[model samples]
Target: MTETPQEQTAADGSVAMQAGRDVIVTNTTGLTLMEARQVAIDVFNANFIRLADEAASIASARADALREKFFDRLSRENPEGLQQAKDPGFQHAFYTAQKEQARTGDADLGDMLVDLLVDRTKHSERDIRQIVLDESLNTAPKLTNGQTAALSLIFLLRYTRNNSLLSHNALGEYFDKYVKPLASKLATSTASFQHLEFTGCGAVGAFQFLPEQSLENNYRGLFLKGFDPQEINDRDISIGLDRRVFMPCLNDAAKLQVSALNEESLESHLASLSIPGEDVTKIKGLFNATKMNHEEIRAKCVELRPYMETVFDAWSSSNMKNFTLTSVGIAIGHANIKRIIGEEFADLSIWIN
Candidate 1:
């Protein structure tokens, strides 16, 4: 299941709620009921804009408390009284459904938000969120202030639904179908220049450079195992000499070899990428945020802290090879990644076996 968006403080002290499952955001401070409603409406409208045209019908058909609140008491109590409502069929169906649902004593609008936010994306998380964004935006012109805030809260619900589906659906499938097998192949390979196929991660064309930080598993013997001390040393030397050594030399003759090495090693190991077709020239631009100067690195890390942490957590939870290889290794990798960034990267070892 997807998680919910959390309320967080924006620079302006306005509560900003991201419309997704990973975090829920809201701030009830500084605003009248009407202004909150307007923000909420704007949010939902923006969400709807992210969807396809077909989702408009679904949005129109949805039973929202926002709309119901606009209705007089007679509309809520008399089925025929709502006949003149914009969507009589839908309203009637909603009334019927709610009537039955009320039997469970959970007919509140909060409970119905799930249905209101259905993504109808044929089960894809991207499609779901896109649908919500699209449809919510489509309904923007018709809402009032209070209705807007209420709708924003409702859109927040949609964001959660879509995020959960995306993580568990798209990402889950990606790891199962590609990351696992490729990481396994690389792990077991004897070649000095190991290659991982990136068919599933959506990368295109020839060999590409991946940052070491991008790697879900520790690049050190990530796939291969059971090597003696001599073998480990040999592998390290081979990695340095065969791959890391020449990365930056291709770009600038005078560039320090160490700088290139850091960029190349970090990109290759962390990003799970490599030079495409002997074009080591691309290594010049490789970015391993951690290997940069402390000031630059810290700034980048702080800006990207949330996303990086999330990625690390998800990656660690999925990568299994390293964790299975040795408890000591897992512990070390976990502590290392967390110290460098945060716990997000620790669980990537879980999915690598």
Candidate 2:
């Protein structure tokens, strides 16, 4: 029997977060404003790099398991055909399946009779197209059956994991110590409003107010900022990415439906974003107009102080602590996508800071 996958505690969910939490906790609290800011930045960079390694390791293990299972099923079902499917002839067979799919619009490519004849996989469209083209060609194909199979397994693991980094309960005890020293510095910084409100948003009180809010938007924002969804662009590792929030509303039975949402569904959701607040608008406009240097940003921050003050008041208040994105903060946040981003997310509407 298996070891039940080692039920991950709130503590051991993410190694990066564990490290970050430790760094923050271990670092002294009496530092100056600049020192505290540097500490936060250091934590961010360490977590970013750590998440990259963790994501790759997770992908590798998931791929290995999938590869074994895929071939094992083939061995049990058709021992003789499994060997034959490795040859170039399988490419031709895949084309035949594609032709049939095109003609009849049948999904599953007639029970996946061809090696590379999948209509869809839990991978990117670009990756799927590359595999399809490789299989269609007769000579010097870019991918072989085994290679494509391995790639498919990796892609499946990535898609299911949600973005590049695997998220379990992050921001556990790590930030608890740092929240105070960092709060004043963060409050003065662009990130003040978002971080201030983030703490209470995860509470049951938040759900009571924004009951009609989409489950995705609920946990997807400020609270989960540390969860990096690192993007891989042609082997380049671009940091500062955020991912979709997990199944906040769904039980185990409906989890499959959440994973089944296709690219079209994702696009539909992306097209609709919240409107930005005046502060975010001004910051974005200044940014777009003149590159938004530090002096200008500082000036804008002064003007935006009242809005941040409201957020600070709510955070201090016991009753209204678990509030949604207040009308005052979103504008500044919308335009101020620098480090102010509660989660380093770029796709905010007016509602989120």
Candidate 3:
């Protein structure tokens, strides 16, 4: 015959134990074994729920922070444009930016989203601006940080110009502060251009394939007004000026030369101002035209060798000649640059249509 169970109660009446074919235990809380097991499950679930709540709270805080930042920038930069936030399109984009910021925890991307939103208010083309904002928000998150960096570097090199005269020392400081950081984040492979093309940021093609004759014709029509045939021929011979050399072989060195000439022109414009002795010495030391020559340009190139190597690596990796940024590309590139550096360096007006 099976033995009958024996039960014992603790002095405090908080626990009970039973001895039988199967022993059962109770807790100090007066819970039976089965009740205690259910309590334990509840506790476990509560802990997980708390953790999930914490994560959600963090995401909410991030989203709120981004929203605050967007409003701050908007109020400061375009106070009257605050009415833009009332538009359905702008509201939709702002909501999307907030959601993405919460989801991705990327504050920089949030800034770019808001930047696009602010830019939208500046344009009168409502439908076009809406499309651009929607498409840009959709594509911006898809880009890796490295790819975004590549776009900014290209934009800086190809599209932008300094608004004010800067001494060589100032230029060097800007390069180190702004350009170098972007270069450091460039993708290792030229295939990045293909990715940019795939994302509708740009097109990768040979520069030679562009409408060269038309461009040359337009150039001659606009700027070749009073030049003599002999002078034109001499200029052409000096630079090997043709469609082939015009675009395809255009490199950083030529671009730098053009920049140097612009700086010289600016300096000449300001030559009448009488600066103090130390200021004059500093300016001359930094921008003396007589000292600016092939060797100086070569030295600048050497200073930029590492960054240029990354650029060459991208080209060699894909064997691509040129990448042209579409409007979408410009928007994203400008935003990324603004995030990496600041508005002072990443001027959107330069690329505005």
Candidate 4:
């Protein structure tokens, strides 16, 4: 039997179907040049419209979800403050957040905007808190999540301290739980710090002089704060001498307390500085003499070393040591940290005075 035109075209490597009087060609191999062009154009237009509609739908859903989150938080936390939504300042911030949320579709960014808008309802436009909130709403959207994370990490290292006894294990756990997730989102290049400076979130070179200060402060907060007196008491008991006699051990320990080293490595380094080939045992004795528990120190170091390495690598890779947050940066970074690590861990009280 002879094949029809459609069957002939199909056999010739062209897909064809009859739609009433029109021949709809999926493959234009058997069609004219103009027909092929028309098909290409139609396909492109159809796909383009489909993708555009999908994008719009996603953006609209995100905006709606953001509004829902905002009202939910406002109603629960500051029901009275909802009245301020009618005020110019609150409306401005709300709209800004909404516009940015639509453009970015970032839930974190939306949450931050919610925080700023909520905060605005609590303060007059003239208040510094409101002023900062206003500025933050403008600036926060310009930042990528990676840039915000970098800013927040720097802020935590510099401006905040642990309120309770600092433990290496706890520090490790904190970073693992709170920081590790964001760390993966960090940009591979140092441009994140540059972007932060350009956005007025921070100054790139401002912290150069105080490069080691954050690390030192962190080290002291983690290992030295309440442990010093305990070490002194332990030394006195072990050596059967006055606590004053073991003060030098505390002093030596302080000198040897390099922020970059874990306890075992630090002790080994300390021993190396002394008589040649000295074992870590002598270093352990030194810590023991100070009444510091060597075993506990080693255990803490075991837990903390990996976390320290991870943080230090991030800092070095991002050139974070050279970056210092401006007041705007501090506010945004504080908010970012609270978002990531929760409010209980995001203490900024030292900046209050």
2 against 4, candidate with superior lDDT: 4
Best by lDDT: 4
Q: Give the TM-score of candidate 4.
A: 0.60
User: RMSDs, each prediction?
Assistant: 21.9, 28.8, 18.7, 19.6
lDDT of 2 at 224: 21
TM-score of each: 0.19, 0.17, 0.57, 0.60
Shift of residue 46 alpha carbon in model 4, Å: 30
**lDDT of each residue in 69-149, candidate 2, tens digit only:** 334444453443333322233323333333333333322222222222221121123443334323332211222222222
Error of 1 at 225 (Å): 9.3
Tens-digit per-residue lDDT, 1-353, candidate 4: 87555432445544333432322233313444333333423332232223377787775566567667777776776676655543445555666676678778888988777766666667754766777778888999999888888777777767765534244466667667666766667653667777887888877774452314543434432433223444434444333323322232222454332222234445544454552233334434444333334334334444565554555566665567677678778878777766765443433333521
Best by TM-score: 4
Name the weakest run of 10 consecutive residues (lDDT summed) in model 4: 242-251
Error of 2 at 51 (Å): 50
Q: Taking the tens digit of each residue's C-alpha lDDT, what string does model 3 give over 1-353?
A: 88676665567644333332222222323333333333322322222223277787876676667766766676677765555443445545555666677678876777787787667656535655457657888888878888887777666656665544234345456567666787667764666667788899888776622112221222111111122223324333333222221221112222211112233442453354443445433333332322333333434434544464454445345423366788788878887777766664444555654
Ten-residue stretch with the least lDDT total in model 3: 216-225
For model 2, what is the error of residue 27's alpha carbon versus the real structure, in angstroms, after optimal superposition? 51
| lDDT ranking, high to low | 4, 3, 1, 2
Question: Which of candidates 1 and 4 reaches a greater lDDT?
Answer: 4
The TM-score between candidate 1 and the true structure equals: 0.19
